[model samples]
Target chain A: MKIAILGTGAVGTTIATKLIELGHQVMIGSRSNTNEKAIEFVNKFEKNASNGTFEEAATFGEIIFNCVKGEFAMTALKSAGKGLENKIIIDISIPTDTSKGAPLSLIPELCNTNSLGEEIQKAFPNTKVVKTLNTMWSTLMVVPTMLKEGDHTNFICGNDEEAKNTVKKLLHEIGWKEGSILDLGDITASRGTESLVLLWLRIWGTTIGTFSFKVVN
Target chain B: MKIAILGTGAVGTTIATKLIELGHQVMIGSRSNTNEKAIEFVNKFEKNASNGTFEEAATFGEIIFNCVKGEFAMTALKSAGKGLENKIIIDISIPTDTSKGAPLSLIPELCNTNSLGEEIQKAFPNTKVVKTLNTMWSTLMVVPTMLKEGDHTNFICGNDEEAKNTVKKLLHEIGWKEGSILDLGDITASRGTESLVLLWLRIWGTTIGTFSFKVVN
Candidate 1:
């Protein structure tokens, strides 16, 4: 499978490397095809890895992972241009505002009533937007078994059922248990998962190690 | 220990009943001393149980539990008046807006940056306000052992260390394991726990059974 990862940051590179290792053609996208970090990332992998502009990368893959920062998600997608049309976008972004000091808070306009996922879905009605893997650290996103043998929970929400199923298969391939992936209804449900980031930040402060949430009954 | 529960709602009654069973003098408060629910509640218990107006209840107990709806928490506290001075308020309320329909959303003004817990703390600067148990179902709040042998997690946050310690002791009496109670710093952290309600409501829609979150590493 061909995958497009939009961003040159830790999240984007980490996921791109993992996908490439799984034999998927992965492209790390940035504002420019000449981005040094994106170039460096591609250099780390021998084959099935490449660096390109957001538009070039989005145009290259069937599935696109919005690994950019939450605040920049829309802008990055827009830069990806017409390639996003009718494609499945796995949105793994949180609108975190670091200006609020330690233990970050979400962007006010996109915090509760509105969310980046809903916003992207509304903006790109032709695209299938599935929100997942935004609740934990980048390292845990690809390797769930690192903590509790992957028994912890992960949530995915979007308007398109097929898109969610595809994302679920991708998650399973990344080592997440079938039962661990929770499908949380529609795109609007992103508000809930996105809000969890605030709690996640606070919990991170206490234990500066890798951790995730498990739903217990 | 004398505990005041300022509301006749399910959460208030549930916690009050448990405290009374643990041999603590419990008072259930409502808008009026003649509230039918409050009277009926007191009738069910022979001793260590009483009902009164918000003011009477707050004055009767050394610690007060703000179990009232989040929208009216400040108003209820104001009605309780000077009795709240220097007392600890265990706020177990979420500013939920059910009008938005199923899987309730938080009130716009109180969702992200601000919270009812912080508002109550700000309103009564002299009082100690600790926010906890607002993230799960009412029954699970007191009897955590009902799920997974109480191995799940609960969070408490407040500006006062002594107040938090006092509340921690109370949580232990309620069957929460000492390690299960996570202290998440100041009362502002309530925004995180309170924001969790949005996610909790969605999760509830899926299982329709009793469940809670356990932070796993």
Candidate 2:
């Protein structure tokens, strides 16, 4: 499947490289010509990933990955334009308030249901918006199954079944265990998960080491 | 410290007996005419836990373990009455809508701002409200350290420092490892955690063999 990772940041770069490694065609989108850090990070994985503007990547791929920082998400999707009309966009956007400018103060914006992810979906209503991947730290997004102990849980939510199924196929192709993928239901369900990210960070930092969760029964 | 467990349900009985086994004075309160199930459950343990009415438990203990169902949390507190004033109420209520009769819905009554735990705090304004134990299943409430490999987290929120210390100490005695307890600050934070109980059910049920979480680095 053709996959365009929109936003060449840490998470964007990590996911693109992993998908490329799985022999899938992957493109990296950036508002600017290049993100030196994101470019350099991807170069380490291989030369297969091509970088371009949001429109170029959007038109080129069947699916889109929303990896832009929450603040620029709307602009990024708008740049993707009419190409997003029926595309499956995996929302990895977290409405983190980096406003005070400290990682510690970067709290989830779910204190309001009208969060940034909600704003992005509103912007591109034609897009089949699914929320996933934002729950894990950027470093853990690649083949997260490598970090799992058993039937772990990675949640996905969207209003479109076909879109969700496409994302699930990609997730499994890149190492998600089949039954472990929990379909949390509808794009709005992402609201709960987006808040869960903040709760996770409170524990992921400090004396405890960061780890992913697996819902084992 | 003398501990009082409100609502003689399975959760309350389990927590009281566990605390008593740890050598604390414990009382279990029930509105159901003192079921034999509670007494029998208590007798199997080495702890000396006595059963009584809400008022009796409140008058006897310095710290109260509030574990009534989400619907009756305030009623249970009110039944306990002025005795709860200025005392530490370790609230374990979540806005779980068992009214659909299913264990899954996050009823409107329980939410990010007005969670059942927070409601209990608002009702007994003088009572030091600490929200914990609502995030994990009732079964894992007793021995979390026995199940996992890392610093899995449990959150607590309250307005009082002394009460947090009291509950923190008790959590340790009940086999929660050091540094595993998190104080999210003030009674309102309880709103987030109390609701997390439903969100947490998915992961807790399968992993840690029944609602156990450990932090790993």
Q: Tell me, by DockQ, which candidate is best.
A: 1
Roughly what TM-score does model 2 have, to 2 decimal places? Answer: 0.73
Sliding window of 10 residues with minimal summed lDDT for model 2 chain A: A102-111
Residue pairs clashing, model 1: none
Retained true contacts (fraction), each candidate: 0.81, 0.09
In model 2 chain B, the worst 10-residue window by lDDT is B202-211
Scoring only the A-chain of each prediction against the true A-chain gives TM-scores of 0.97, 0.87
The list of candidate 2 runs beyond 4 A from truth reads A20-25, A30-47, A51-53, A70-79, A96-128, A143-153, A158-166, A172-191, B20-25, B30-55, B97-110, B113-126, B143-153, B157-162, B179-192, B201-211
Q: What TM-score between 0 and 1 does chain B of candidate 1 receive?
A: 0.97
Report the poorest 10 consecutive residues by lDDT, candidate 1 chain A.
A96-105
Chain B vs. true chain B: TM-score for each candidate? 0.97, 0.87
Q: Tell me the alpha-carbon RMSD of every candidate.
A: 1.1, 5.2
Model 2: per-residue Cα lDDT over A120-157, one tens digit each: 66777788888887777776666564564424567787
lDDT of each: 0.91, 0.70
